[model samples]
Target: MYMILKSMKKNKLRNLVIVVQLIFGIVILSNSLANYKYYISTREKAENASSSNVYEVSVENKADIFKVGEARDHQYISGEENQISTVYKIAKESKLVEKIGFEGLGCNSCQYTNEEENEGKFILKSKIKTIGIVEYSKELTEMYNFKMKSGMNFSQYYKSEKAEDVIPMLISPQLSKDNPIGSIVKLPGGGKKYKVIGVLDNSCPLLNELYNMGCLYKPNNGYFCVIGSLLTNKKTHLYIKLKDGVSKAEGKNDFDKKLGEKFETQFFGLDDMAETVTLPAPYAARYILFGIIILVLSSFGIINTVLSTILKRKKEFGTRIAVGATKAQIEKLVIGEFIIFFAFSAFIGLIIAKLISGQQAVWDFSVIGISIGIVFLILVISMIPAYFRMRKMNPVDLVHGR
Candidate 1:
């Protein structure tokens, strides 16, 4: 190792070129791995939610219907509840649909007016926006395949026909991990208290984001049901999961045709089919393609640098061989030097990659292991050419400057 370092130092220009090339290669490799990991995670999240089989129908409302002259009337709220029930009913009636769910105020989270007064009098508090309190049911949970982290699903016993005891609610995975099951979460302004009957181990980005943003899942029913909110103008999102062996083609042909006509007849405002609202995978093919290009270019650069360095040091190998150094020793020295270079370049590259990759940069053991594996791979690829070249070298020919 000492000799290898000494030799690298002796050949400043060549080592500099190799180091620079390696730095570039390692940077590219680290970034590519990070991107690859991100894409893999995104794919997992999408698949976990069964996105391919699930479709979303956006329930928009006609603005003109609620408008009174220049301003919209707060008392004129309508359409969402009926539209939601109708969609659920149709999906339930459809043989192609396996499960259905709905989200009132399609946004992942929203503000709620909550105020509880003392002395049997109501005191109003300033309205505040909260996260993740989506209006959904057990069907919606099934549609998204939300796994329970702790406790059980909403009990049939707890699904009261009317708002009586505290409504059973499911919290996000993050919330579940932080809070205990059966814990009561108070709504904003101490309005309603929901018992955390279930915890959702979901990676759905939007849901997670809402949870992170302080949204707790509460029953979108009782006194606070979205229908009665001042923000009743917000739309509901209907989600449906098709049964296995049922294709989107069937949905387009039969379901879309009927749904479009029904909405038009009812004048419910939306015109597009459910398929139009398919959640796009956050990372696309271009990210994978660019990662591939970076890896290919980096590998090529490493291979070129290794082969050049070996050829440039042929005379040194010849001198070593003449001095009674065995073939194995020569090979060992060359491989060792390259390994050291690979480690140094990879380490520096990783540091730089993390510094520049912003919030996405991660330095966990898995990432470190991957970085080492990538450097080892580059070393192995470069060694093939170096090994063969060294095998052909002879003391007499090399000393004669051949």
Candidate 2:
């Protein structure tokens, strides 16, 4: 302990460099851990949203698809509506298909507008961010496989023959508690109003991310309204949940073969447009690679410092050897000095990291434990030169300064 303090006091600059290296290593590691936690949480939510065996199909009117400038200018027949009807008929007849639904074009970043009355004057307040708006069929619940938290799904009204008098909506549980069942939600720009009929489970981060972030709603869980002309609109997307043992490729092949026979000129397929649901960010590899690089550099710095210290204290080590100290005792003394330095540096690093990142930084204990392990690994690396120096220490070398 006395030798450790003496060494520290004599090699202040070298010790300071080691301390700075430790601080940098810990701060980098803690930041990476915080990012890793965020990435994992988002990935888990995305995974939960996609556990169902659902497939997507995109279709557009053959005429509208070919000539795309202004949709309003095209005076074409409703090819999309006909295709949707045919697809629905084919799906219902197939034993391999379970449920099917249609979703209109939606945006993840849009604004929600509403009116607020301030002293007899109506003021407009816009919620600048939303998950966009989409028209979802009753069968969407089956396709999404979301557990209903409140009210009911639109399954009973899935049939085209049974026209709905009022639009019904199924929302996330975060949105449902405030709106409740039977409450009316008005759309922006004075459009159609929807009745909140159901609340979905905590899953489905697609919609829930915006809701949880305070972007979707002003006073409640946000609002959903039926829009677009359903099957007639080319912007609509088909979501189909296949029966057990059915792969997406198989489903796509069947749809292509069947639809090819009907629409000779137009192309309608699922595999070309759809992607499997998973968080696209490969944060695990990115953070791990960076961490390894930084730690390697830090370890080298520590090793250099340790070697320098040993080189400067060669006479001191020789004197100890002459005084009948064992090589093992000298080694312990050298290793013990580093152990204390590292332990104290780690403590200071953690405290500074917490203060800087604030509450947003998630400190995973597993990550912290791994960091400590790495510190010890660095200690072992730094001790390699000391181990060899102590082993070679003798009375002649101590006196002659070899």
On lDDT, the candidate that comes out on top is 2
What value does the lDDT take at residue 151 in candidate 1? 67
- Candidate 1 local lDDT, 1-402, one digit each (tens): 776878778778867776777676667656656654543553455445434466664333333243322222322223656555546666777888777655545243334343333312222111333344555654554444445556665443245435545656666554554446666555444455566666555433332232222221233211121111122334356667777898766754555454543232121111122111122222323443444355446556656766777778778877877788787887888788768877788789888877776343335677668777767775787678777877787767766556
C-alpha TM-scores of all predictions: 0.61, 0.58
Supply candidate 2's per-residue lDDT for 332. 77
lDDT of each: 0.53, 0.55
Mark the 10 consecutive residues where model 2 has the least summed lDDT: 116-125
What TM-score does candidate 2 reach?
A: 0.58
Model 2 agreement with the true structure over 1-402: per-residue lDDT tens digits: 887687678878877877777767766665666555554554454445533666655444434443433232233224555546656666767666787767655443334443412211211122333534556555664444344566665553343325555566666544554556666555443344556666655333342232233111222233333332342344345667777898776776676565543232222222221211213224544665565566567667766777676777778877777778766766777787778777887788777766786333447787677667776776677668667866766656764556
Worst 10 residues of 1 by lDDT: 267-276
- Rate residue 252 of model 2 by lDDT: 60
lDDT of 2 at 370: 69
- Runs of candidate 1 with Cα error greater than 4 angstroms are 12-17, 26-55, 59-101, 106-131, 142-144, 155-164, 173-178, 202-235, 240-315, 318-324, 347-378, 397-402
Task: Report lDDT (Cα) of residue 360, candidate 2.
Answer: 30
